[model samples]
Target: MSCVKLLNDFPFTFSREATYQVCEKVETRCSFLDKLGIHLAGIWICECSCGSSDLPLDHLRSDKGWSLPNRLCPCRGPLSILKKQLCSWSEYYEWRGISLDSPVALLLHWPLTMYQAIQLAFGKQLTNETTDELCIHYLGPERELYQTAVFGELHALLPGVRVHIDFVGPEVPHDRDGETISLSSYAHCMEANCSCKTPISTDDSSKITLRFHSGYYHDCYEELTKEFLPDLIIAPNAGIAAYKSWLPTIELIREIEVPTIFSDYCEEACHLAANCITSVTGTPLAIPVQLNPFRHPLAVEDSALLLPCYSNCFLFGI
Candidate 1:
């Protein structure tokens, strides 16, 4: 099917409700997600101004902020890290909502496999097979304990809420590429910079429904479209109360009315897919966010070594 005809996944109509009759927090908003017993979890990764706060794994007693050159903390200081995450969606949303006049937008830079700041509420089985011993730092006792504690606390707070994680679009038969694809841990997976779709040698001819779990808007979704128009863009629900930085990338899809797949998986997958694909439009989903390691601007020798994992899934917002 032609890509244009195959990409339509993001809209549904709902009967309007009396806003004035609903509660303050409920009535002021205009979203139809409540019908599906779903809540819009806006994951805002904002450039903090005063920095909500961060206490690295090493230093937990004293609260700290992420350093600069990383995520711009509107908290006025960099609190995240090259590999470490600095904040949380819950904290970010609470603070940013009060700060912005109209709805605010943000840009999100996520490490496809290795999550730094943006993480799924319910932790997943994290895997790292790097040569360096420190690579296991993410899976250490302390980190695992942290994940357990985070989930424990969340489970207590959000009674029946589900948890999910997101990967660079679902693993297609095609190799994945991304923009600024970081090869820190799995550098050996590819050569310095080569262009050979290695691992993701999938049935490219077969169309797949690429999915994602996001708390962004259509404007940001369009950013990916402008860079590389994918088949369809999908998200669980919008009009959320979380996310200090709802990426403008997803928002772009809505603005352009790019057909999108809406899922209720914000509470399920890391990719924020939906519970059920109600709109069976035979739409194909593709996020033009892939990177070609073999084709990167690197030394020839290095490029030769990093060819195995050369995928198109390493791009901007995959």
Candidate 2:
């Protein structure tokens, strides 16, 4: 492939039907590996939670990259190409030494190592120090087991005054922590940030919401090294904000592990709002998305491959 072929394309397209058609025609030793996952086709790399466009594909999927792909991104996350092969952006093991086995811890970075940060989790030895490590350093951890802490805690005190979590866009600078949001901004797009995008009812879970999504939009090239592959990664708060139009709450939390679910349910809503795209740099909110480089580089192009779980480099919904 030529560098020119991998530069930039606004609306990146894939031959999903054609790819699938061809997939159906052939059979490999690992039929599952060769049977392209339906969601992997025709993705826009830019929608990735990270702040990078494709690394010329040469850097990411080159012959050399394929030889020692683990060196590509130390954080054990997913790859855009893998999504096409495996149903989830994760499942890196299928590709051999190309993905982060420790997806959740991979998202966190040093100064507060991902491993150390995760040590202070809900089920583990969660203490004021541990909670402080996560709350102060990462804002919120992105492990699926901690969904209650990340998504729950919504307690509406009165009518029209419900609790809710949201992504107010990237407005601040990088903090090496979790995504930061502007409550006022979320209030303005109230409907856009709902759990199911529906208003709170008496028993609505979101009535008591938690807003720990996208923060700053940047990449992990600076931190990740061949010598020291990150065991964890930060979130991709900014990039997700860049695609705010096509984003929502559930996708915010579960996009990586459950891309089809997010795409099937939230993609339409987010795509519809694309017309009013807002520049994240100009906003008053920002959060750092720690991800495992084991995942793909931060997605900045229009085509992106959401991970099966933390393996996807991103800040939850960002």
Candidate 3:
């Protein structure tokens, strides 16, 4: 089937009331595929961004605002990384109408295999031995966690999937004896400066190729879409929220015509992406249902399916 047609046929209808039901359906379908020893492969986009409040006072005051170059705090820490640390997953759930004791809440602690199963059910999964490739774009300090999640989840679902991770931010920092040290001593991963293909193997024989590049939106778009074409995009609101404006990245996705699975942490970034996609595809998109005392949730007008997780966070495809 054509890629666009496949995306349009994804098995879930967007509805706040039926989000959990859709997740259950995905799980059931993926379970059936696993029993057949079938493996599916596709490229997925994973990205992170910081909250605007995390920006430093000076950086926020600059003519370019949060878009200023070398945007870091006085302590030499990336604001995006700091904001990630501050995000309260528990609070997010509380806002979603899910209590800690609820059975659905247990899904949060489910293994990455379950998550991958859900993802595989959304897009076309390959049955061949050819390694499935997943492309991840991350910024700030939480990248390691994001990488671990991606790897773990894929490993759970498809043990042979290959992962390509692109770290699009400043050098990771290390703290030793109260001194902060930048890992600049390590080789850079820019498409221009480094070899595009470098392989690292996991314990289970899954291979991962790692790359690092500047987090500037234009640079990231050039490398991800033009240099490394992916089948699916898994964009995180936090990563995209780092910028005051993410039109270029949104436009890049529209131009590439790749199926994207967006994770919404903040309502504003989610709305921006939904609106951009709506304009491109001429499909009306709306924010998800609002969770009281939190914020209006992001919802797409004609999504194939919508699954709300952790209350405020949502997963949907277009």
Candidate 4:
């Protein structure tokens, strides 16, 4: 299937109610899933700004946000990674209504994974205290450009702190190269009476600001860091081993030592990237390969391999 078809079939902007209505009737009796019908795996449900606060893992897993068979033969393999998440869904979701199966949580995974990587590398220095503003340099953003508004979840996930993300990559649209978007409020539901629609008083507001730079990170590094340096750098599903362009970027990251982290679609990719980084920069990973708790809950289409693959399933640091 074409990538555009996948994007259209699974609109990430749908409201939570609308998403549930679409997936509620899907039967879970089948033991195997066909590629054509796997679009449900990509379903996204943007829960109202606040789905009534957080709930326990047991409750979250028990509820249904999307459909899946009782025993899908393919899921028993790599897809089982979802059941072995590194952190509880509560770490990523502050709401009770969204299920662990929902891909609505996927877009927010970028920020949540950044939060986890920060905690892993810097301990509590950045996140424990609310006084310090955190700046992040995010690399290689494509589809995420369309999902920018969903990133407002970062404000709720990291309360009382200011976050500035500079999205630097060649895929960034030329027209928006230097445009900056400031998010002052959470993404709200379609319902007019949603309580989250209540405007925040000036005294209680915090902003998550994002800027776009259209080019390779290394090519734009000098200008991007001229004013302020990032506390951390993140690249999601970065095919480091596949691209020779990553060599110079890897060297640059080593020189700066800014606690950069990357995630891949699978363990093999993470391992390959780890080796590439070690060979180029003569430096080993600061954070070893491990599963990402906030990874997307759907399987990606891959005909060349027998093992299942999902976006951002594994993470490592350099």
Give the top-scoring candidate (lDDT): 4
Q: Local distance difference test, per candidate?
A: 0.22, 0.24, 0.34, 0.59
lDDT of candidate 2 over 67-186, digit per residue (tens): 112232222222222222122223433342333422211221211122222322222433332222121112222222122221221111111233332222233222312332221111
TM-score of every prediction relative to native: 0.20, 0.20, 0.40, 0.70
Off by over 4 Å in 1: 1-223, 236-252, 265-318
Model 3 stretches with alpha carbons more than 4 Å out: 1-131, 136-153, 169-205, 224-227, 238-244, 266-273, 285-312
lDDT of 4 by residue, 1-318 (tens): 133222223323332222232223232212112322333232222121122123222221111222333221111112111222236455333242344443345456665677677766675534325354778999997656655655665565555567888999987767778788776655444344544455433233345788889999899999898766998899988999999988888888888889888998767788999999999878778889987766654445322543445567778897
* Candidate 1 residue-wise lDDT, 1-318, digit = tens: 132111111011221121112212343222322332222211111111111134232321111222211122232211231233223333332332222211211111112222321123113322221210111001001111111111211111121222221222221112222222111111011122332112212232211121221222332233334434433332322212233233343343335544333221112222322111112222333332222111111011112222221111122221
The model with the greatest TM-score is 4
Give the lDDT ranking, best first: 4, 3, 2, 1
In every candidate, how many clashes are there?
A: 97, 65, 15, 0
* Residue 235 lDDT (model 3): 45
Locate the minimum summed-lDDT window of 10 residues in model 3: 66-75
**Overall local distance difference test of candidate 1:** 0.22
The true-versus-predicted C-alpha distance at residue 74 of model 1, in Å, is 43
Off by over 4 Å in 2: 1-35, 40-129, 132-166, 170-209, 212-292, 297-318
Q: lDDT winner between 2 and 3, please give it.
A: 3
The lDDT of model 3 is 0.34
Worst 10 residues of 2 by lDDT: 59-68
Ranking 1 against 2 by TM-score, winner: 2
Please give the lDDT score at residue 229 for candidate 1. Answer: 43
